[model samples]
Target: MKKIRKSKTEQLNFGNYSFEVIKKKIKNIYFRVYPSKGKIIVSAPFSIDSETLNKAILSKSDWLNKQVKKAAIAKPEPVKTYITGEKLLFKGEIYSLYVDYRHTGPRVAKTFDKVIHLKVKPGTDFPQREKIIISWYRKELKRSIGMYIDKWQPRIGVTVNEFNVRKMKTRWGSCNVNAKRIWLNLALIKCAEKFLEYVIVHEMIHLLERKHNARFKSLMDRFIPDWKRLKKELNRFSL
Candidate 1:
C-alpha cells in the first residue's frame, strides 16, 4: 500500500534553505532531510510558533547545507513515453532503449554494447510497457542485492534474515535491525555497483549503530571514505 504523505502546514526560509514546518499532533519536533534532492522537512507540535520553528531548523544548518548540496545536483527526469530511441539510466550509465515486439511476454535484457533490449508483446501500450520495465528492474535489483549482501554480511559482521526489493519514494533502502532484514529500493538498479555497495554497507552498519551519530559516520568513513560524494552522485538523476 502507498503511504499518504502528510500535508505541509507552513513553509519558512532559513539560511540557504526553504523548508516546510508541519504542525502535527505529535509531542516533539522532528527534522528530516529527504534523500531525494535533500528536501528539508520539520514536523513539530501544533503549539510551536514560527520563530521557534525557524530557530530549530536553523540550528541544523551545517547538516542542512550538505543536504542542499546533494539536492542541487539532482536532475529531474522528464515524462517518459517508453518509446524507441529513449534513454534509460542503469548502473550509473545511460543506455539507449530498443523496443521490440516479437515476444509472447515482455522481457528486458542489456547488451555489452550498452543497449537495453526490451522485447514485449506486439503493440503494447504505455502502461504495459512501463510495467514490463519496472518488473525487469525489480528482478535485476533483487539478484544484484543478493550478491551484495552475501559479500558484505561477512565483512560487516552481520547476519541478514531476509532482504526485500520494492519501490520506496523517499529512501534507497531501509533496515529492520531487530529482524535482521533489509529492504532496498527498486530504483537502485539504476545506480553504479560502487554506489550500490555504499548503500548496502550503510544499511548493514545500521545493524551495528541504530542512529546516524558519531559512531555511524565513523563506520561509514572506515568502510567507504567517499560515501558522501557517491551519495550526491547517486541522487544526481531523479528516478
Candidate 2:
C-alpha cells in the first residue's frame, strides 16, 4: 500500500479512543477521523497552525476512535484472478470455469455438468478472455430483464417505460425518473434470482420515490422482507 503523507500544516493528535487529524483547507479547518478502523486521516489547508489542528482532532477524540475501529473492522473484497478451473458464483451456486483455446473468436458455452466453458485462442490474454465472458453475460442479462419486468410491473403497481442492461462500476441499478427508464448491471446475473428481483424492485420503486428515504425502505419491506440479507449475499459475489 502507498503511504499517506501528512500535510505540511497538519498535526496528528493521539487519544485513548481513536486516531485523528486536524487539516486546514482553503476554505476551512476540519478534523477528520476514520473511527471504525482506528485510522485517522486529516486534511487541512496550508495556512492552519499545528496547535489549532491538534486541538480540533483531540476534541473529537471519542467519535474519531469509534470511526477508526469501525473502519478497521471493515474488510475489503479480495482481488480475484481469472484462471481456469476457478469456482465462480452464478445464481447462488458455485460453478467451475473451464478455459480452452480455439481458432475462432471468444465463445462461452455451457456444459451439461453446469460448467462455463470459455474458448479463446491459445495466446489470448486475460483481458480478452474477460471481455468475451462479460459480453456473454450482458447478452444473457438482457434476455432475462424483460421477463422480470413483465412479472413485477403489475405486482408493484408501477410501469417502467424503458430499461437497458450494461456493465456498471458503482451501482447495480439506476433509474431515470424524467424518462421513466431504468438501467441494470450485467454483473447482477451472477447473483441469485431473488437478489436480482430486489434490484429490479429497487429501481422500480425509484419511479415512485426518487431517493432512498423512509418511503423507499417501506416500499421495499412491503414487497421483499428479506432484502437486507439478500443484498449482503449479493455483495459477497464478484461483480
Candidate 3:
C-alpha cells in the first residue's frame, strides 16, 4: 500500500487546531487517514498554504490523532445509494416510494402504510422531478419541525420561540439564540431517522450553548452518543 505523505513546506503548531482558509460548498472540513494509519487528514481548500496549515494541525496533533483513530474504529458508512424503488429514511424509519405518472404535475402524497407516493407526469425532466420531490421535502420538514421542537424542548430545558424551514447551503440547521428561534434545512428530510434527530438535537442544544465549544459537545454527547457517526453518515447523502 502507498504511504500518505504530508507537504514539507507546511508548518506545524499546537493547541485546539483548525485551518482558517479552507471553504467548500460543504461548510465543514473532513479529516481522514487511509486504512486507519498515518497523520491526521485535513480536507480543505487546495489553495491553503501547506506551511501554515501544517503548523495548526501539529498544534492539536494529540486531539486530531485521537479523532482519526476513533474514525477508524467507527462503524462503516451507511449505504445511501440513490436508486429507483429504494426506500428513504424519515424521522427514524424507512419510507418507501412508489413512483407513478397519473398526475398532471408532480405531487407527493402519503400512503396508508407510511410510504411517500410521488406522482409525476410521464416523461418529466430531471429538474421537474427534483423540484416536485424537493417541494414535498419542504412540506414534510414544516410538518415535522413542530413535533421535534416540542419533544426536545423539555429534554434540553429550552423553549424556542419560533422556527422555520428553508434550503440552507452550509448547515443542516441553525439557531438564533437572541430570538429563541431555529431554522432547519429542508434537505434533512432525506436523511436517516437518527441523522434527523441529531440535527434537531444539535440545534436545540444551541439554545443552551451558543457556540460549538466544549459545553456544546458535552451536551451533544450526553444526548446523542453516536452523533459523530451520524454526522459522517449524513455527509454521504446528496443535499
lDDT of each: 0.81, 0.71, 0.67
Which portions of model 3 miss their true places by more than 4 Å? 1-99, 103-106, 110-116, 120-129
- lDDT by residue (67-173, candidate 3, tens digit) is 54444333243453323575655543457767777747567877668687778778776677667777777778777778777888898999989988888777888
Residue 120 lDDT (model 1):
85
Each model's TM-score, in the order given? 0.66, 0.59, 0.53
* Of 2 and 3, the candidate ranking higher by lDDT: 2
Query: Which candidate gets the maximum TM-score versus the true structure?
Result: 1
In TM-score terms, candidate 1 sits at: 0.66
At residue 63, candidate 3 shows an lDDT of 68
Ranking by lDDT: 1, 2, 3
> Candidate 2 clash total?
25
* Candidate 1, number of clashes: 0
lDDT of 3: 0.67
Question: Which candidate has the top score in lDDT?
Answer: 1
